[model samples]
Target: MVFGANSIAFFMFAGVVARLLIMWPIGETSLKTWLFVHVFRPLFGSLNGSLLFALSFLVLSYIFMYWLYRKRIFWKV
Candidate 1:
């Protein structure tokens, strides 16, 4: 579970980095631009949303894993 969580986190970070790099050249670098860049700019904003979703999933998965471990529970199919 730790490995899975770490892998998800790694991918999320990588995606965010790639997005920032892509936007760097065209970025306005202003406060208003920064805010607008996310919503008004589709490509820039989609990646941000993806990263946020992945991070939230990773956190929830880790919490569930910890809970299962503490309860000494395991699932079998």
Candidate 2:
């Protein structure tokens, strides 16, 4: 499996880190809201903005993963 345990764990850890540092912080903008305000709201309307943002984020994540794979930078257990 190209996407093995490390990949899953990396994403989970990233989510935790994002929440801890960015999303969950007091008086700060969460990633989703920032995307909506800056990128999605302008290109797509409010109704579809959130969904498109999520899809775009997923695509970008996969692209980053592929880049890391090409660089042989897989996280170890």
Backbone Cα, N, C clashes tallied per candidate: 0, 0
Give residue 53's lDDT in candidate 1 (0 to 100). Answer: 49
What's model 1's TM-score?
Answer: 0.39
lDDT of 1 by residue, 1-77 (tens): 54343554445555665466556654547433444456444654666756664565567556756665567555433
The residue-level lDDT of candidate 2 at 77 comes to 58
Off by more than 4 A, model 2: 1-6, 9-31
Counting only residues 3 or more apart in sequence or on different chains, how many pairs clash (N, Cα, C under 3 Å) in candidate 1? 0
**lDDT, each prediction:** 0.54, 0.66
Which one wins on TM-score?
Answer: 2
